[model samples]
Target: MEVDVKLFGDLREGRFEQEKTQLEENSRVIDVIKKCNLPLEHVAVCFVNNCQAEFGQVLEDGDRIAFSPPVGGM
Candidate 1:
């Protein structure tokens, strides 16, 4: 299975690639993040195919995942 992925914030900067990536079948959202070495603690939000998702969410083929890092400031 192939999944479309989008990384935001520091993760993208670290990987230097914002393009979609293909992953194996039954891959979880956290799996992709791990591939980029991103810490879930730093993520503010995550979406799968436009719906809010969690680390345990399983990704399907053609699924689109997006990540946004947490921002802190007053």
Candidate 2:
């Protein structure tokens, strides 16, 4: 499966702000985070298809996810 990922704040450092990423079947939101090598502690807000989502939320193919940090931090 594949999903679109958008990273905000320092989460983009050493990474990309947006990209289409490949994933295994039944992957959750947190799986995408780990695949991006992101720091979970830095994620202040997360949305899936524009709705607030949790780390354990299951992702569907072609889902769009945006992750943001707290204002100035990541």
For each candidate, what TM-score against the reference?
Answer: 0.80, 0.92
* Candidate 2: tens digits of C-alpha lDDT, residues 1-74: 99999998788999998999999999999999899888888888999999999999999999999999889542
> Which one wins on lDDT?
2
As a whole number from 0 to 100, the lDDT of residue 55 in candidate 1 is: 90
**Among all candidates shown, the one with the greatest TM-score:** 2
Regions of candidate 2 where Cα sits further than 4 Å from its true position: 72-74
Task: List the global CA lDDT of all models.
Answer: 0.80, 0.92
Error of 2 at 6 (Å): 0.5
Which pairs, if any, clash in model 1?
Answer: none
In the range 1-74, model 1's lDDT, one tens digit per residue, is: 77777777775775654556778788899898887677868777889999999999988888988888876650
Candidate 1 wrongly placed segments (more than 4 Å): none
Worst 10-residue lDDT window for candidate 2 reads 65-74
